[model samples]
Target: MLKIYRNTSIFIFLVIIGVQWGFYKNYTSEFPNFIGKTNIIHIHGALLMSWLVLLIVQPLLIKTGRTQLHRTIGKVSYVLGPLIIIFLFLIGKGSYWRAIGKVPEHDILRDMVLDSRGLISFAIFWALAMLYRKDAASHMRYMIATGILAIGPGVGRGLINSFGLGIGTALTVTDLIALAIVGFLLGYDIYKKKNYKPFLVVFIVFLIGAFLWQVRDSDTWQSFAKSYASMFY
Candidate 1:
C-alpha cells in the first residue's frame, strides 16, 4: 500500500511538472518571463516542489524500514505546509491583480474561488494528517488526499493546454479526475480493510469543494469575489 502510494506520488509530481512546463513554456522562450516573476512566485514554486519531493521521499523511507528517518523528515511539513498555504494566497492574489482588466470577470472569479478551495482543502487535510500521525492508515490517507487537492490546478491546466479545452470544461474534467481518485481509494479501503470512512469523508469534502468551484461565477460569488479582490488588489 505504501509503495503504491509512493509511486503514485512520483507519477503525480511528473504530471504536475509537465503541465507547468507546457502551460508556461518556461523551458523555451518564456524562460526569462518565468524566472523574472516576483519573489512570491519563486518562493511558492520552491516550497511546493519541496513538499512534493518530501512526499515522495517519506514513503520511500518507510518502505525501506527507515521509520526514524521518515519521522524526522516528516517534521518539515509543519513548516513547509503553512508556507505553502501562505504563498498560495500570495500567488493567487498576484494573479488576480494581474488579470483585473486583461482576463474575463467570470474566469477570474472562478480561478480565485477554486484556488481558495484548494488552499482550504490542503490545510484541512494537512492538519488531519498531523493529528493522526500515530495512525499510519489514517495519516497516509489524509496525506494522499492532500496531494490530490494540491494537483487540481496542474490537472486543470493540463486539460486546457493539452486538449484545447475551455476553462470551464477543463475544471469539470479536473473535478472528475478527483472523484475518480477518491473512488479508487474508497474501493481499495473496502477491499483491503473493509472500512472506507477516511475516503468517504474525503469524497464528501472533495465533492462540496468542487461544486463550490463550479459555481464560482454565480452572481453571489462574483459579488463576493470582487469585494475580496478589492481588499487585496
Candidate 2:
C-alpha cells in the first residue's frame, strides 16, 4: 500500500506538471492556441512551464543517479525561482484584478501583492527545499509542499473559468483546496516519517487568511488596485 501510494504520488506529480507544460510545448500543427501577447506574460509562462517540467523530470533523473545533471539544473532553478516570485507579483496583480471584475472598491494589485499568503507559502517551502538539498527526504517533502503551493493559482483559475462560478468564491474555494492539500501532505508526512512538526505549513496558511483579512478593509488599496488594473484594460 505504501509503495502503491508513492507510485500514485509520482504519477500525479507528473500529470499536474505535464499537462500544463504540454499546453505550451509550442504552437504546432497538433496543438495551437498558445496565444498571449504580453512579453512578461509569455516569458513568465514559458519559464514556469519549464520549472514544472523540471519538477516532473527531476525525480526520475535523481533515481537514475544523474545527480550531477540535477545539480546543474539546480543552478538554473535558483535563478528562475526568484523570477517566479517577481512574476507572481506582476502577473498575479493583473490576474487577481481580472478575476475580481475590476471593481472600484478594491485594489486587486495590492491584494495580490501585499495580501499574498500563497506566494509566501511558496517562498517558505521553496527556500526550505533548497536549504534541505543535502537531506533528500526533507528536500523531497518540501518540494512536494512547493508543488502544492505552486498549483493553487492554476487550480483557482480552472475552478472559476471552467465551472461557471463566482470568481471571489471560486478563488477562496481554490485556496481552501490548497490548504486541504497541505493538510493531507502533513498527515502523510507524519505517517511516513513519524514527524508532525509542520510549522512552516501552518505559518503559510495563517498568513494567507490574514492577508485576505487585511485587504478586505483597505480604501487606498482598493483605489490603487482598480487603477493598476485599468492601465492594462
Candidate 3:
C-alpha cells in the first residue's frame, strides 16, 4: 500500500509538470496584456509558478523518505495551498466576466458567483485536508484535490486555444474536460482496484456536484456572490 501510494504520488507530480509546461506554453503569450490589466494577474501568475514548482519537487522529497524536511515544508504548504486556490478562483471570476461579449440565456457573469463549484470545491477540500492533517490518506486527498482544482483553468485554456470554441462553449467545454479527466481517474481506480478510496471519493464527489450546480444555478450563484462579498467586507 505504501509502495502504491509512493508511485501514485510520483505519477501525479509528473503529470502536474506536464500540465504546467502546457499551461506555460499555451498561456504565456497573454502574460504581457494580462499583467498590464490587473496586478492580481501578476501575483496570481507568480504564485501559480511557485505552486507548480513545489508540486514537482514535493514528490522528490517524499520519494527520498525525507519526512522531516517534507513535514517542515508541508506546514508552509498548508497555508499557501488555500491561498493559491483562492487566487485562482478570483482570477477565473475576473477572466470570465471580462470575456462575456453577448450574454446568452446565461453566461459567465450571470452565474459566476464565487467562481462557482470549481473554486468553492477546492476551498472546502483544502480546508478538510488541514482538518485531517494527522492522516496520510487525508493529505493525499488534498493533493489530488489541488491537482483537479487547478485542472479546470489549465484544461479550459488549452481547449479554448486548441478548439476555438466561443466563450461560453469554450469555458463550459473546458471545465467538462477537467471534470472528465478527474472522473476517469477515480472510475479507473475503483474499477481496477476494486475499491473506492474514501478520501478521494469525497473530494471528487464534492467537485462534480459543485461544478454541475454552479453552471446551472444562477440565482444561487448570485446569493453566493453576496456571501463572498460579506466574507471580506
| Local accuracy by lDDT, each model | 0.78, 0.60, 0.61
Residue-pair clashes per candidate: 0, 3, 0
TM-score of 1: 0.87
TM-score, candidate number 3: 0.70
Sliding window of 10 residues with minimal summed lDDT for model 1 = 21-30
Candidate 1, 1-233: lDDT as tens digits: 66776676686577567546555543233565665578888777778768777877788888778999999999998999899888888888888878889999878977788767777788888888899899888888788787777556776776676778887787887788888889988998898875588789889889988788778778988888888777865
lDDT of 2 by residue, 89-147 (tens): 67666566455765543444545533355556667777877887887666766766656
CA lDDT of 139 in candidate 3?
62
Off by over 4 Å in 2: 1-36, 92-102, 105-115, 198-203, 206-233
lDDT of 3 by residue, 101-144 (tens): 75642454355533555566766766766777777665665666
Error of 3 at 117 (Å): 2.4
Clashing pairs in 3: none
The window of 10 residues in a row where model 2 has the poorest summed lDDT is: 22-31
Model 1 stretches with alpha carbons more than 4 Å out:
5-29, 32-36, 104-106, 230-233
For all predicted structures, in order, the TM-scores are 0.87, 0.70, 0.70
